[model samples]
Target: MAKETKAQRETVERVMREWKDGALETSRGAPVTSQQQAVAIALHEAGQSRDETPAKNRKNLRTTKAREAKASETREVLYAEATKRGIPGRSRMTKQELVRALQPR
Candidate 1:
């Protein structure tokens, strides 16, 4: 395989940073999947224009949205149940907190 140029290396590093830091989320705040990351990397490597990145990113965003939506639905159900059971502070908890509280005791 050919060696990566500095520009290519920089681009890859940027993408990896975004992926690791959860910047590839949808407007609704869903985390992008590995598959989506792969697609974004592939597109970037192909020398796709910067202006076109958003469209390509949106495609991946859709998948993340779907996954997040499903997870949200499940969390809502769990949260409601927790509230009904008088779990203190459930109302104030964020999603991550809710998950921890709802985990099997």
Candidate 2:
């Protein structure tokens, strides 16, 4: 494995600081609740996480499909939640739109 560069470390540190300050969140806009969780998420975003298995030794296609299936399930759940809340025009909103609309003001 290649060594991590100074820039990568700096980036991770910055993200960690932001997360600790409640200024950063996951792609879904959920706040990170812990420093350890922040480190993992930051490293994954930087492509420097220690937990990634070698792609050649893994079933890449199956993993990708599984992730997609999970995302679809999440979208369905969000849609249903929005429907339950009686959000106007929910049927016409995309998943992300629903998410944004559902966020507390």
**Candidate 2 structure, TM-score to reference:** 0.45
Tell me how candidate 2 scores on lDDT.
0.67
Best by TM-score: 2
| Lowest-sum lDDT 10-residue window in model 1 | 61-70
The reply for model 2, stretches above 4 Å from the true place, is 53-105
Q: Which tens-of-lDDT digit does each residue in 1-105 have in candidate 2?
A: 767666556656777888878987876778888888898766665556657764521343333334434445567787898889999998888886876777655
Query: Superposing every Cα of model 1 onto the true structure, what RMSD results?
Result: 12.6
How accurate locally is residue 18 in candidate 1, as Cα lDDT from 0 to 100?
68
Cα lDDT of model 1 by residue, 18-92, tens digit = 677767554356777685655565445434435466566455434434433444666678689678877898878
| Residue 5 Cα positional deviation in candidate 2, in Å, after optimal superposition | 0.2
The window of 10 residues in a row where model 2 has the poorest summed lDDT is 56-65
